[model samples]
Target: MSNFINKLWGSKSKASKTVTFGDSSFVNAPGGRIWTFISIATLILLWVLSSIFEWVKPIYWPPIQDVWSQFLVISSEGFRNSTLLEHVAASVGRVLAGFLLGCLIGIPLGFALALSKTMNRIFDPIVEFLRPMPPLALIPLVILWLGIGESAKIFLLFLASVWILALAARSGAMSTNLSKVHAAYTLNASKRQILFHVILPNALPEIFTGMRVAIGVCWGTVVAAELVAAESGLGMMVMVASKFLSTDIVVLGVILISLIAYVIDIFMRYLERRFVPWRGKAKH
Candidate 1:
């Protein structure tokens, strides 16, 4: 995970370090693949056994089939006056709206902060003040100010995701190679030319890294945002189900959210690999 993160942010150290990770040939070996399958199978087998033996009450941890049946049932009969798809759509829509809005504004602001001392001095304290405050903590104020509408939820999620992205963008810009900047100056390149051609290229990796982090942070706030007030969302579904002691549905909601977050993260990583394949390495 650490290696993956280092790769994502292009963690260029002061010295040119040649670090070799474990070879793919070894990791992809038949033996390694067998262990990987075995690990996953073992967990599934344990879950089946526990469910069969009633190690825990069915109410708390239902059998795999029960969850599956519940999923099918929800698909057909709907949950809390809405279909499963509707619930998912509600949650996904809110997250995307909030996340995209944050990115649209936060990314450029972060770069500006890193590039301009005046901008940094003006906004740094304000961002810092809010960064450490949990989005949930602001829920009451948001409700009072924005009301308990969709805007409140989106705002909370925006706050949840924005700070990390801003910080990442700033770090990436600051990490621009000083020697390269000086060389550009020697070549009589204007500040705007150097920023567009040199700094942005180096900072792209970190900007994307922050985006990845921001997505996770936004996801973390999904349930909290919905819990405050939501008509239809996976979070709302989970909350409503829990009211009837339906742990299966709650767990199912959790699994679905995890799956969605995982899928998005994978896509983000693919984008990073495509755009900045030369991560955490010095330029030739």
Candidate 2:
């Protein structure tokens, strides 16, 4: 009887091992895809139900179908005699131009402040005073100086983005490991060599983080700038829709802005992963 019991237990163990290691296709099932589909379907259902129930009335909450129709109409008919493609191009051009300009100035200035004590002392107080003021608050001055054209809008965007980016770069530079700097010096490395090989690489992660934050801030400022004075772009579309009580068009504009921001954030994450592989591994 003991022999028979041992045989039964041995057979059970063998079966378990087979299930664990042999032909286990179930372990590779696409759970992520399933969850994504379910989540999207649930959201659509909820949106449809909300619209059917007249839940957000008086304030002009449009249904998903209406928003889709509005999007189609805009795609077909255009806004302010400008095609959707044209508006998108204009907005994207402004953002890239302004963001690039901010980076060019902010990065070098930040590095200077970080490396030079004299410069830091001279500029830090002035920067601190200016940093607290919102970019939107300076719109009047921006308009007065640059006028109500593309120049003013881009200027506002640059102002909104530059300070945050500069501060980030300075912080990154300051926070670079002192031991690494000392080690580079001991190894007969020049100051430029130390900065390029030791400081910049170590501070790269922080710089990327700063860029992400700056991108979001820039996006918000773009919308605000367009709202204040613009004949085209997503913000202008929303403003026009609001004036005419076109809730569907307004919703479409809001969704498009959100979608664009989301896409940009995804691209930023890709960049972070590609450039900061060490940081990614450490996170896991």
Clashes of 2: 0
lDDT of each: 0.85, 0.78
Model 1 steric clash pairs: 10-280
Screening candidate 2 with a backbone cut-off below 3 angstroms (N, C-alpha, C), the clashing residue pairs are none
lDDT of 2 at 222: 77
lDDT of 2 by residue, 78-193 (tens): 98988777777777777777787888877767777899999999988988888888988888998889889999888888888788778888987888778889999999999999
Worst 10 residues of 2 by lDDT: 25-34
Error of 2 at 37 (Å): 4.7
lDDT of 1 by residue, 1-284 (tens): 87655544444557644654653423212222445567889988998998888798878787877888889988888898888889889999999998998887787788888999999999999989888998888888999999999999999999888888888888989998799999999998999999988988888998898888899888888999997779899988888888998888988888889889989998998898788877755654
